[model samples]
Target: MLTEELLTLAAAAGAAVATAAGTDAWEGLRARLGHWFGRGDGRRGEAALAELDGSAAELLEGGTPTGGELERCGAAWRDRVVATLERLDGPDRDEAAHDLRRLLAEEPTAPKIHSGDQHVQGDIRVHAEQGSLAAALINGNVHFSPPPPPVRPEG
Candidate 1:
């Protein structure tokens, strides 16, 4: 089963990347994930967010994750985050690293899976930037289909 700390790391990584990427892509990805999780303006998205937020208290033990898992999660997060970074190429990779360092100074929120018995074997949090970096690194199966465009409220 997945540990808690790893999941939190992924979340922090994603959040850092997203924050570095800026709010537009981050928000867009958030909306996309909302659709994938069937959370379009519903409690589902809220739940999903709740599920992926908190602290990593008891994850990251045992031997390092398998090679396949690391590739999967890393690819997913790298795909979205790297793409966005490339598009918004104001800061270089080194800058992104600096941003990540700043994020580490703050306590990051942990990803809370609903069921404990059903272990998460891979990264499933849609975008690699959503939950645990380990999940992205380990390829936990937490992702689903992308969400539709978010509807804006009228003034």
Candidate 2:
């Protein structure tokens, strides 16, 4: 059983993880999350990173953006975070909760973007820089395609 504070921390971590997916904040969050759960273990960090990636992919193509799947994933992660916190005792748990709070504090300000239901008689280009392109439909039709990978600058 988690205390109310721990429960809130777990929920915040879960929601922040979900919200940060596909955004610029994701990589930083991922690394910090990996370190948090991994505790300086490389293998554990990689595994945690993979899980985060999988969650983002699933949420993107779940056919119900911002729907039940989101809640389900959030709950799943909340459980996982709570379980991790449970393993720690006293000062360590407090430290873990503080780390979680730090991570959640980095969440970017997400904007509500709704396409369609408006006049789109011209070209519509939605450049959602450093944010999630969620719940945006094309021509008022549902398109379940994942956004393309970000282009990297060549050095």
Candidate 3:
């Protein structure tokens, strides 16, 4: 049985696979995932690559995908990852999990904004609705001051 941590990691890997499709990171992620799944078998590696390519092609077929489609794709890959992990045993499973962790850590991820520790590496947009306020502090401080009063015209 897979531990909670391993399950979480597999789910994340699945999501990463789905998210990386069609992006600049796609090729690297695909190659790494294929290599991992291949497990030193050339034919298996080629087959895995082909499967990944098909997934990518399907994902990118109609331009941007709907949220439902993306979720479906993610779920499918998540199941595949879980199945792969479940098939291994003992030291093999441990080593495969380690490799998966390494793969995830090495791959580039989209910009993330977290409380007290925001690290953005790509374009970020900050928009405020009417009568609202918005702020995005990349690496700077912000100061707020009252607007100057309108000057009255001399008679």
Candidate 4:
């Protein structure tokens, strides 16, 4: 049972694994993550590295794991991270979380599009119908309705 913070960090680790897939940052991030999870054990690091590679491969097997696929990937990574966190203590856990955050910070989360109120990501080609929804350009090409106007309260 991981704390909420650790769980969130785990999710970040998962997202980093997915977002960095097929990019140059993948290898470095993977190595760093493996070493961190390994916690000074070469064999442990290698095992973690193998698991990371497998996760990335599985997520990208069909296509860019977007939507549900992406969610699953993130969940899977979170579980692995949680398991690792459970086995660690004090400095080890802190260091692991810090390392995971560093990896996440170094990797940018591709791009996202909003569907109604949802933030969706990846190389999605939006074909939004119904009025000017297709005119929203985020990060230069993608489009959405700017997440709807903020509601104002009584004056």
Candidate 5:
């Protein structure tokens, strides 16, 4: 049995993988995870890559996923991580857990929004580096106005 800390780490890795799918960081995260899971085996590495691709495809299917879908996908990956950790012995398990922590730490937390060709008919809230803000309702077209010029300071 794995320690609580290690189990938590595995859970976080799984969540991170689920969150990284279809985002800008997806490719890099996917490659690193594949290599980690592969553990120097070429066939295993290829299989891992295939599995990751399938996860991404499932999450990206249709469009925005429902909350249940996200939870299910995350749990699936978490189980995979836990199983992998269970197979390792002593130091190997610790090292794998450490690697997972590193991967999670390096992952970008910023959410990426891809509108693609979908049309939005309701209000949307956008969260970015600048901060969260409310978006106006959309009928069909979208427009953006430049920020007003900064006020000059009195000399």
Candidate 6:
């Protein structure tokens, strides 16, 4: 479980970023935080963690101009993330995983949208049944690109 303070800060940070810079920036911020707090990383620090948490909370709640617009906002947010991770060690760092999970869960979830077509519905059903693929999609890794197969050499 995550502490109330931490969850509040994380949620606020996410909301603030999205509100200020649009959803693209918010998703990037989440990914960076997730990477930092993930358990597998070997790096550790204390001051960095505290600073990040503090700065994030402040930014989320602060009513400043968020000057330099997107650039400053992005830099400030990134700096806090780096600083906070710099302060953690061992157990504290490990515990960041739970914090991140809770923070990520705070992002508003959207119901999976399905196409009305039968083929699309079938594809969704099939992919949703695959654990790994489903997890990736659920985590927002679903991307748009050319469909696989049927390639031809160009002159």
* Backbone collisions counted per model: 32, 0, 0, 1, 0, 11
Error of 3 at 39 (Å): 0.9
| Stretches of candidate 3 exceeding 4 Å from the true structure | 110-155
Q: Stretches of candidate 5 above 4 Å error?
A: 110-155
What tens-digit string does per-residue lDDT give for candidate 5 at 82-125?
A: 99999999999988877776776676631222223223222122
On TM-score, the stronger of 1 and 2 is 2
Residue 68 lDDT (model 6): 38
RMSD of 1: 17.0
The candidate 3 region of ten consecutive residues with least summed lDDT is 146-155
Residue 92's lDDT within candidate 4 is 78
lDDT of each: 0.36, 0.63, 0.68, 0.64, 0.67, 0.39
TM-scores of all models?
A: 0.25, 0.64, 0.69, 0.64, 0.69, 0.31
Best of the two (3, 6) by TM-score: 3
What local lDDT does model 5 show for residue 14? 69
What tens digits encode model 2's per-residue C-alpha lDDT throughout 71-145? Answer: 566667778899999998999888887777666555452212122223222112332436766353556654354
TM-score of 6: 0.31
Q: Write the per-residue lDDT of candidate 4 for residues 56-145, one digit (tens) a residue.
A: 777766654556676676667767888888988899788777777666555555333222233435333333446646443455455454
Model 6: per-residue Cα lDDT over 1-155, one tens digit each: 43334433333443344333323334444455545544455353343344444444445453433433323444455345444544666677446634654454344421121222111110121124345653223433455543222112121
Candidate 2 clashes: the total is 0
lDDT of 4 at 46: 94
lDDT of 3 by residue, 1-155 (tens): 88756766666676666677777687898999999989999898899899887877787677676555655666677778889999999899999988887887777742222222334332233446688997855566544543222122222
Give each prediction's root-mean-square deviation over alpha carbons.
17.0, 12.6, 15.3, 13.8, 16.0, 16.8
- Give the deviation of candidate 2 from the true structure as CA RMSD: 12.6
Better of 3 and 4 by lDDT: 3
